[model samples]
Target: MMTKKHLALSALLVAVLATTAVQFFPKTIQPAGITPPATAYRHSEETSSVEKPCSNEHPEWREAQMIEGVDIAPAPACEPDNPYEVATSVKGTNNVSMMTLMQTDLAQDALVMGEDVDKDGDPDEIHIKLEVVELNGSSPDGEFLINTYPIAPGIQPGLWVYAPKSRGMALKNFNSMVAIPMLRAPSPTIRVEQGDKVFITLENTHYLPHTIHLHGVDHAFHNSKGEDNDGTEEHAVFPGKSHTYEIQPRHAGTMLYHCHVQTAQHFMMGLHGIFVVEENHPNNWVQTFNVGAGQVRHPSVGVKNTYSQEYDLIYQSIDKKLSQIIQNATDPRLVAQRMSRDYNMTESFENYFLLNGHSFPYTLRDGIIAVNDNENIKLRIANVQRSAVAIHFHGHKATITAYDGVDQPEASRITRDVFDIAPAQRIDLQLSTQNNGVNSYGPGLWMFHDHVATGTTSDGMEPGGNMAILAYKPLLDENGMPTMHDDLLNEVFSKDYYAKKQALWAQGDFKHLLGDAGLIVPPYWQIILFGLAAGLLIGLALVFTLKRKQA
Candidate 1:
C-alpha cells in the first residue's frame, strides 16, 4: 500500500490529468437544424420563359440580354468615317423614334415628351406611377422569385424596391404570358421641370407597408384634409393599398425619394431613387424616369445645353446579416419584425457595395464612362451608404459644380481627384476629358473607384465593389472592351475570383514568388513527439520532487 503523502500526491496528479483530457474534447454550442421553420408565404407566382423567334422571320426583334430589368440590346457598329449615322435600340428613348436619336441618346435615354402647357413646348403637369416590388424573395414553397437581382456573382440579397408601372415580364428578354411588374433597385430616377405640378402614385403591391418620403424636396407637411402629406410610416400605404403624393418643387436640383416606413430598415432594403428637377425651359421635354441609373437616355433640353452626357451615380452598401434575415423566414411579419426590431444596425457591418445596382465587374457592363477628347461629362453622384466614401479617380481631376443639387458658386468651385461624399450627400462633378495636366492625364483606360478601403471590397474581395472605369473611345475595342488591359479578363471574370477560391496572382509571372503554397500542417510524428517530450519532462520533475520529499 502507498503512504498517505504518496496517495495525496497521486490524487493531485490524477486531478491534473483529468483536467487536461477535458480540454481535448469540446461540447457543441449549437447543433445543426436548429433554425425554426417558416410559417406562411406572402405571395407566390409561377414564372416561365418563352422561345425566341428566328432572326430571319423576326428581323425587327434584336437579340437581348436581361440586366436589372432592362433589355440590353447591342449598340450599332461604330463608323469612324460617319460618326452621326448609327443603328441601335439600346438607347433609352421611350417613345421618340430611333430616327430622331441617331446622334444623341446613345448612352442615355431621351426625355418623355408631354403636352406642353402655355404652348411652351414643355410639360407642366407630370403623373408617375410606382409599384412596390420584391426581388430575390423566398416563398413558403420557395419558388416565387423569377427575375433575381444578383449584386455580386452568386449572391442575391432579398430586396424590396419601387419600380415604374410597365407591362410585360419584370426581366427583359424573358418571354412570359404573366405580366409581372419590372421592379428594380435604386428605383427609377424621377425628373420634373422646376415649378411643374407633379403627381407620384405609390402602389403598394408587396406584403409590407411603405411610403414615399420626398427627401430634400419641397412638399407640404399636411394635405388639405389635415392628413400627413410628407411620406412617413404614420402615413404608410398598406399592402395592396395606394397613395398619391403631390409636389411642385420650387428649386432645380438633384434630390432623393425613398421609403420612410421604418426608414432604418426599409430604406436600406433598396426603396430609393434619384429625384431631379430641371430649370423650366420651353420645349425642354425631360427624361422623366431613368430606371437603373446609367446614361440619361432622353436628357432634358436643359441638360443638353451644358453637358453632352449625364450619369446618375447612386452608391449603396448592404449588410449581409440584414439581407439574409429575409431568407430565414417566409412570413412577412417575421421578416418585418426581424428587420425592424430584432436586428441591431450598430452591431452589423456592410459587406457589399453597389454602383447602379451591380458590383465591380458587372458595373463595367453599364457604369463605365465612355468619353471623347474634351467631352464635358456630368456625374450626379449620391452616397446612400451608411459611411462616407472617398471617391478617387485615376488620371482625372473633376470640378465640383454642385452639392446636393445646388449650384456651387464659381469662386468656390473646387477641382479635386478625390471627393469625400458623406451618407445621403449628393455631389455633381463636371469631368472634362481635356488632356490638360490639370483636368485629365490623357486618353487611356483609367479607374474611378471608392477610396474607402472597405468600400472597394465585396465581402472582403478586392476589385469587387462600386469600381468603374473611364475609358477613352480610342482605347476601347469594338465590343467596348478595353484594348490595353493589365488584368486577364478570363481570370477576373470567373466566379471563383469573387468566391475567394482562386488565389490572387496565381497566373502571374511572379507566381513562384507570391503564390500561396499551403503551409505544412503539423505531422502526426511531430505531435506525438511533442506530447511524449512534455510528458517526459513532467514525469522527471515529479519523480525529482517525490525523491526530495522522501529524503
Candidate 2:
C-alpha cells in the first residue's frame, strides 16, 4: 500500500533508528590481545607537591646534618665466613628462607649469596632479587618533587629501583635522604665475581613489561631446557611476574644491564644499571651493588690493588617531553595509548643532563670526587646518555685502563685530559692526583664537566647540568661536601636562577652585553614578502625587455 519513495524513506528511518539504538547499547566485546585497564603503579596522590619543601628534619637527614657524618668512605665488605649473617636477628638461609627474609627486612637491599654448600670458602651459587619501583625524586632545592631528575621543580614521571636485598638492618629504618625509596637515575650497580654462578631475578612491580639484557657481559642465549632467559623483547616479564637470568661470567670487567623491552623508551626511563664482574680473587666479596651513586665500598681486585679509592660515574640526559608521557595519564590503558600510539620520538630533544643521579649543584652535594694529594683514584665512567659527551677533567689527565669493559694494552693505554665518550660506552680511567707537571697541574678544586657547552645547563639555564668538581681533601668540608667560592654560590647559582624566574642580567647593568634580537617576523610572512618583491622585479624586467624588443 506504500509508494516506492515512501518505502525507501521508511527503510532509511528504520536504519537510522537501529544505529542510534546500537550507540546507546554498545557491544561489550573488546579487540583481541588488548590489555585490560590496570591500576597505575604510582598514583598522583602518592607524589609530593612541588611547592612543598622536603623535610630535612626527617630522621633521614640526620647523618647529613653533621659535617663529618657524611661517610664518603666505602662500607666494609662482609666476611666470607658468615656473609649471609647481617645482624644477630637476621640470618640468611638457602631454601626459601633467604628470600622471605629479604622481603621482610627493610634493611636488605641485596641478598648476600654466600652459601658454600660444598664447604668451599668461595660461594658456589649467588642469587639476587631486584624489583622495579615507582617513586618521586625531590628537587635539589627541596622546592618540588618529580619522577625524573629534579633539575626543575615539575612533576616529571620516572622509574625507581630496588637493589638486591642485603643481610642487614632494613632500608626503611636507615635514616638517610639518599637511602629513601624514590625514583632516581642510574639503577643499582650489580657486582659479581668471575666464575661464580650468578642468578639475577627481575621482579616486575611496575605497570609495564620489562627485561634485563646483559649488555656487553657474557650471558647465555638460552638457559637449560631451552627456556628464553636472554631478557630480550621476546621474553619480557609482565607486571607482577618474575624472571631469573643465569649468568656465569667468564671474564671480569665493567658491563651494563638494562630493560630490553621497548629499549629506547624503557632505558631512557631509567631502567639501566652498572654490572661489574670482578676477577676471582680470594675472599673477594665485592660490594654486590652500588645503589644510586656514591663511594664504591667494595672495590674489585683490579681497583683495590691499583687505586686508593673508586667512584662510579654515570652520565645520562633526559628528554622531558618523552618522560612526561608516563605522568600524563593515571590509568594504565591511557598510558599505553599515549606512549605507544600518540608519542613521537623523532621530535624529542634532551633538556636535562645528569651526573650520577642529580644535576650540577646537587651533584656537588654528593658526587664530589674527594682525593688526597698524589692519590690514585679509579673512575669507572659510563655514558648512558643518548648523545656523545667529552669529559674534560680540569687541571689533570686521566690514564685510560679499560674501554667498554675491555682492558687496553699498556702501550695502547692513552692519557688524555678530555675523554670522548659515546653513548653506552664505558671508560675506566686511573685518575692520578700527583702534583707533577705532566700528570696534574697540582691539588686544587678542579672542575670536571662535560665539554659539550649545553651539557652544563639545565633546561637551557647555565651552571645547572652535569658539572661537578674534583675537590682536593683540603677543599672538602667536614661532611665531604665541596666548598666553592662565595661567588659561585651567589644568587646566580640559586634554584630560582635555573627556574628562569630571576634575571641573569640586572636592568641598567651595562657590564654584561645583551645578545642580538631573534627574528621578530613570522617565517611564512617573510617568505611571502620575498616572493612579492621577486615577482615585481621579474615583471618590470619582462616589461623592459618586451619594450626594447618592440622598439
Candidate 3:
C-alpha cells in the first residue's frame, strides 16, 4: 500500500479530478439586490367581458358590432404558377357616368380606369381601393420573402399598401407582385385630379379599426344624403368592414389622409400618406395612387407644364417602443389593451426617422430624387411626425409655392434653403436645378435631410437615418442608383457594424472579438494545457511525499 508506484498514481488521479471539476463547475457571482431585464414581450392580466379566445377576433371586439357583410381573411400565399393571373371583373354604374374599370391580374384586384368621358384622353372618374395590411409579421418581406431592400436589414412592425377589391374589379392585379403589401412605413400616396369624381374605398383587413380622414381637404361633415362620410372619430370603420369615401375637391395642392381615431397612437403608427389633388386641367389623368413613394410618371397638367418631375416626400418619426407593441402580442385583445390602455403616449420618444419609407442608405436606393441640369422638379413635402422638421437642401434653394394645399401668391412665395414644416403641415417646393451657382451649386451629390440633429441618426446611430440625395443623372451608376464616396460607407454607417458583431462587421479580420479568449478557449488546446499542468503538479507532489517519508 505504501509503495512509491501506488502513491504516485494516487497523486496523479487527485490532480486530474481537481482540474476536471474546475472546468465543469465554474465559479459564479451574483451581486445582492440585482435583477435581470424584463423580456420584450409580456402579457397583461386585464380581461374582457366575454373571455373568448382571440383566434380570429376583430380589433374592436368589445364595441357594438356593425356587420357590413364583407369577407376578411388572412392574406393568401403567393401562387408561383399563376402569380399574375386575373381572377374576375365586375361592371357597375355610378352617379356621375357609366364607368368600366377593368380588374387586372394579381393578388389584389386593380381597378383599371381606361374610359374617358371628358373626351380629353384621360379618365375623369378616379376609383381606388385600399386594404390595411401588417408588415414584418411572420414574414419580413411577406409574399416576396426575399431581401428586397438590401439596406435596413431587420424585422420591425409597420403598415403596408394593399390594393383591395374595387367595384367592378377584382383585388389582385399585375402590380400586386411589384407592390406587395407588408413591406415598410409611409402608406401608399393617393393622387387624384381636382374635378375627377374620386372614390376611395378602404377595406379594413387589419385586426384594428381604421378610417381615412382626408386631412385639410375639401369635404363636408356628411354626404349628399346626410350620411356620415367624413372619416372622423364617430365614423370608425371596424375590422372586416369597408367604407367608400366620395369627395370631389375643387382646390389642387398637397393634402393628406390618415386614421383620425386614436389620433396620438394610430396616426403615429404609420397610418398616413401624401394625398395630392392636382388642378383640373385638360388631359389630366393622374395615377390614382402611388403605392409607396417614388417618381410620379404621369404628372398633372400644372406640373407637366412647369416641372420636369415630381416626388412625394413623407416625413415620419417612429417610436420603436410603440410600434413594437404589434410585434409583441399575437392576440387581438392583448394588442388592443396594450396599445389603447396600457401604452403611455406622454413618454413617447423618437427612435427612428424615415423619408418616404426607408432610412439613409436604403433611401439612397429608392428615395433618390434624380435631377438633370436646368430642370425644375416639384417636391411635395409633408410632415406627418409630431415634432417640427426643418428641411434643408444641401446645394440649392427651393421656392415655396403652396402651403397646406393652398397656393401662395407669387410675391409671398419665398426662396429658402431650409423650410420649416410644422406637424401635419405640407409644403410644395419648386426646386430649380439650373446648376449656374445661383439656382443650385452645379449638380453634384447634394444631400436633403432634416436640420434637426436627431433626425439624421437612427436609434442614436449617426449617419444612419432619414438622409437622401438629390443627385444629377451624370453622378448615378449604370443601374440608375446614386453613387456615393467611400467615406459614407464606413463601418458605423452599416446597421450591424455599429453593434460590433463579427458576422456583420469585418468577418475575417475581427475574429478575436467573437469570444472572450480567457473565458472560452479552444477544446483541444484547453485539454492539452490542463493535462500538462495536472501531470507536473502530480510529479512534484510525489517527490515531496517521498522525501517526507524518508525523513
Give RMSD (Å) of candidate 3 vs. truth: 12.9
- TM-scores for all candidates: the values are 0.74, 0.71, 0.70
Give the per-residue lDDT of model 1 (tens digit) for 282-362: 876666666677666556778778887788899998877777676677788898789888999879788889888878666
Best by lDDT: 1
Evaluate residue 389 in candidate 2 and report its C-alpha lDDT on the 0 to 100 scale: 95
Candidates' C-alpha lDDT: 0.67, 0.62, 0.62
RMSD score of candidate 1 (Å):
9.4
Better-scoring candidate (TM-score), 2 or 3:
2
Worst 10 residues of 2 by lDDT: 76-85
Error in Å for residue 417 of model 1: 1.0
Query: What is the TM-score of candidate 2?
Result: 0.71
lDDT of 2 by residue, 1-551 (tens): 34476456555655554454445433332211111221122334334322222222222322312111112232221101011222201122333254444433323434545575555345657778777755443333333323333433332334444444333432234333223332345686777778888788887767788888899999888876477767899888999998888888998888888888877777776777778888777655566656565557445555778788988888888776656555444557776787667877677677778887767666665577777788988888888888999999999999999998999999999999999999899988999989887678988889999999989977676676789888887775544455565434443434334544434442234225642222122234445455555555555555576577778
